[model samples]
Target chain A: MQIEAISKANSPEIACVVLCCRIFIKTASAEELEQFVQAHEMDWDEVYKYAAFHRVRPILYKVLDNCKIPAPVLGRFRNYCRALSVFAFERQVESARIQQVLGQQGIVVRMYKGLDFTKLVYGGDIGMREFTDMDMMIDSRQLPELAKVMTAEGYECSQIEYLRRFPEHYVANKKDICFYKRSPMGKLFGFEFHHRPGNFLMDQSIGFRELLGQDYLHHSAPFSQEQYYRLMLLNHGASDYFPNLRSLVDMALLSQKGIGSVPEQLRRVERLSQELSMRLLDGPAAATPADNVVMRCATRITKLQLTVTLRSVWERRYMHIRFSASFSDTFRMAMKFLHYLMLPNELDINGVQLFSFKLYYLAKMVRCVNFPGRFKKVFSRV
Target chain B: MTQHDIVHRNEKQFMISNLGNEIVLMDIQQGHYINVNPVGSVIWNKLAVPIMVKDLIHSLVEEYGVSTAQCEDDTLKFLQKLQQHHMLNVQ
Candidate 1:
């Protein structure tokens, strides 16, 4: 997919943000960036909020520090960047420690997305990228051992109780288990252990282990560059519905390294995400007239899917089915989602193990019936 | 310590990054970090190699155009804080 230039129709704040990110990714020249910044009457508050919302504050700070921003706004950006730098550094240290310990226990794990990509794309500058959790891929068989090691390291597993009570059900339904630990500074760090890559609805015919190959266990570079980019696009973009601009920046940077063609199943979503990024961040000349009409319709659908106020379980399930690879995949995903909704998990029952578990399902059905009235009350206030 | 003492960054004890004009120092043992302002960044960069307090003050006074007396006072206080955090090594 090709990334076009930022659209001129964007608000001043959005334009500045897009331009700043473009400069960071080296797609736009610094002189062009300076000219755009100087010509516009920018709303610094909006720029800050938009950057934060998109999880691109670090990139914004990095690119705009050289531009002629107001001193107070620059200071705010710098302060945030510095704080994130500290957090990223701490996450790196903690991750390395965890990896070392896990390695000693004969479990092989691979880091993804966060500091790993920071090293790969940002030249090891942690502050320029932000990630919510430390994502690592491990062999499914090693999960029990991994959990023990995590608990020993003062981490609390989110699914420990569930897994302990109904291991079979938990494994069948969940792709990853998250463990969290709080730092002395009171910041929480989440470490997600993925037994399989991609979302629950993603087709798992080719497992991550197979894609990474036999030497994955001990190879210094477990995934080839192509495989890494593909997994990122699928897991980060399509799976999570392209939650923020950071994912697009990641794709843009990876593409610069010359990624092969995206998988056939992922092409549409990848194109749409790339188009959205280009439409918002870059100019619009790359798309032909025919392509723009299709993109316009797709972009609206994506925006509606991403709209927080309108988001619901039904909307998410629709997205899952919409993005499914095949007719069979769609049916499978719909069935899985129905299973997820009808069945009450440990959280729903407050971890109480019942003899039948059917009683909880009945309660769930009653709650579903009352949901519309409850939603009406909440929606009225909004 | 007097102006004759030599000081340098405790590189072995902290993971440091130069973030634009500011500096971030993460204490490896403590898992906490300190943000050094632009002036502190200048001082930290200069301390890359061992230098005497008098020379450090001379460089700061020249670069920032501050009074020698004021630079010495502020630099000493900053260096003392680093020492308190164990982020500096004095000789």
Candidate 2:
């Protein structure tokens, strides 16, 4: 009659890992707790890594508190949670301070994504989730003034490094770019100044320009709660090959009454895979993926699974109808997508610009050969 | 409505979280925070369950070895501040 034990045995290591984490912070008896640990074989470290990586260490703390886990691990997790909570509070205070200044200047700032999503999903407990950056949407014309304001506050555009390296990056991408400032404590805070720009990977961005004249500036967030959750479900798998587990967890929690989160993620991935398969028929277009291996894997699977049949006919109609764009637009996006891979961006040496196509391709080659460096830099930064 | 009325009232309107040494009381509807110091932190922990002002003061005085008069005075002041911040309500 042990549901936990049954679930653990029936599910895979990954599913059980997510399942235990999904239920760990919630009410659980000793038997449930035993199965939670027993289900995790060579997965404790992996779960911890994902928890920390996704900034859900605070969530992990609550789960581990009821266990007979080692003291050192528990203590470190507690400390991490405490530090994260403090940092989140400071950032919230900072946001309030900035909001005041911007308000006085009559600049309507629409906060969204990162922390806004956290507040809606986790109820403003900063420790409950981790947000390394903030997302604020302003009117497109307000960019210069925001740049001035951030610069006055000793903050530089976070995209400055990327833009410097790839001069066309500004034109190639959407959104107003992000501003950066290092706190006195050495934490880098990024404020993404998004205006939507109608250039998301799926090209289904909310009408940024249309909402400009409205008073959504005073809105709680960029999108309503329903829209926010839906966007997370949609965007998580659109151009990205893999769905983020934590985002999936958030979606699940947000829509618990609906489809279960992990199953929802698998469905989204399946949907997006179809979209990518359509793009493969057209060109090597869409958002950037890491390497040729990913590109080949996706293309090979879709090619075999696809035929000039009823299902393929429906998929072709579905994808094209979903995205309204011309062939030229697709061609431009294809080049831009490749350029994103080739250019010296966050994934490359900072301040290094390779403007020419040849130089860009060379950098791309080097990046593929030195893939471990990418993971190293990310871990180091975190 | 007044400091006397808030003295023993329980918190029901606001949501709260304990971050180890500190506690954060939030008014989700208004998006405001009532932050407190370590001494005020103890008061927050005590307020988790209902207790009279006199009882809270007595416990604090015993735990900190302070005089009853001083404990009562400080507790009243903290309670008054909580009332001003709209964190307290009628039990």
Per-model lDDT: 0.73, 0.55
For candidate 1, give the lDDT of residue B72.
92
Question: Which one wins on lDDT?
Answer: 1
Q: For model 1, how does the per-residue alpha-carbon lDDT over A111-162 read when each residue is reduced to its tens digit?
A: 8767777776776577778777999888777877788889998999767776
Best by DockQ: 1
Interface RMSD of each: 1.7, 4.4
Summarize candidate 2's per-residue lDDT along B1-91 as a digit string, tens digits: 3333425434566555555445665565565666566688888778767676767787899999999888878888888788777765545
For candidate 1, give the DockQ. Answer: 0.39
Q: Per-residue alpha-carbon lDDT of model 2 for A1-382, expressed as tens digits?
A: 1334433444333333344445542423445555656655534555466555444566666666666667776678777766676566656656767767777777777676666677767765656776677777776656656666777878876555554444444434545677778876688777777655344334543344332335655555345555554455444433333223354456455553343223332343434443442232121223434343334534433333222112353343233223323467556666655554454445443423544634645655666666667545633543
User: Candidate 2 — which residues are off by over 4 angstroms?
Assistant: A1-17, A24-30, A38-47, A158-172, A197-200, A204-215, A218-223, A239-243, A257-336, A339-382, B1-5, B8-51, B54-91
Count clashing residue pairs per candidate: 4, 0
For all predicted structures, in order, the TM-scores are: 0.76, 0.59
